[model samples]
Target: MARSLDLACRCAQLADELKAKDIIVLDLTRVTPEFDYFIIATGNSRRQLHAIAEEADTLMEKSGSARIGIEGYDSNAWILQDYGDVVLHAFDPASREMYDLERLWADATRVDWQAYLAEHA
Candidate 1:
């Protein structure tokens, strides 16, 4: 389940474009067989949450990636977008606090977004 560098770079770009706070890309290849990476980020409000999710979708689409599904946007508390190799979770602070993916997927290795983006440059 090793993810390609291109996938990681795309994920980071999406996170950056959305102005996601404390963005972290998690490598789930070794732990979860379902997806390769988890792009998790936080938004301050419902508006921000929706914006971030939509921007990610747009980026994925432009990159020739088909979205499999989307959820939790009704409340804007959390939004999940399935993009085959990558799964994006954009959430409001409260929802993010409630369903902390970092803590939930503790087994998955944490990726330093800054370092990752720098290396890719």
Candidate 2:
């Protein structure tokens, strides 16, 4: 659980560094067994979304996390990077509003990403 939280927070930090908007870390451990957490964020454009996903992939690999799969890179609407325990969603504003993952997973707890990072640091 600690390792999963650390990786999710690190991914969120990377997205924030690249200026991804409304970055959030959702604790889905109790809600779903498929993934432990979800790091969701919005990008200003398709280019920015790609950039965020690319950086996230690199960072996850560097941290010894194996990427399970990636989807929607070409479409650039909603890109999903799956790292087994942690999954990242980089979406444009329109797609974000359209899917509304937050609302769909409303029962999941929102982890205080900054605090988690600081504590782990």
Candidate 3:
């Protein structure tokens, strides 16, 4: 659980570095068995989304986190990167509002991403 949380927070920090908006880390361990956490962020454009997704994949892989699957990168509406325990969602503003993942996972606890980053820094 701690490892997954650390990975999720790392993903969130990466998103922040790329200037992704409204970055969030949702703890899904207690709420769901499919994944340990969800790292969600909003990108302003398809180019930005692709860059964010690519960088995230590279960073995770460098950290020994193998990406299990990736989807929607070509479309760029919403890119999903599956890193086993940590799934990342990079969405365009319109798609983010339409899908509303936060609302869907409202039961999950939101990790204090900034605080986590600060503590680790």
Ten contiguous residues with the weakest lDDT in model 1 = 1-10
Better of 1 and 2 by TM-score: 2
- What's the lDDT for candidate 3? 0.92
In model 1, which runs have C-alpha deviations exceeding 4 angstroms? 1-5
Using Cα atoms with residue i matched to residue i, what is each candidate's TM-score against the true structure? 0.87, 0.96, 0.96
Could you give candidate 3's per-residue lDDT for residues 40-120 as a string of tens digits? 999998988988888988888888998999999888589999999999999999999999999999999999988987898
Could you give candidate 1's per-residue lDDT for residues 63-100 as a string of tens digits? 77778998998985889989888888888888888998
Model 2 C-alpha lDDT per residue in residues 19-105, reported as the tens digit of each score: 999999999999999999999999999999998998988998998997999889889588999999999999999999999999999
Residue 11 CA displacement from its true place in model 3, Å = 1.0
Best model per lDDT = 2
lDDT of each: 0.79, 0.93, 0.92
Query: Ten-residue segment with the worst summed lDDT in candidate 3?
Result: 1-10
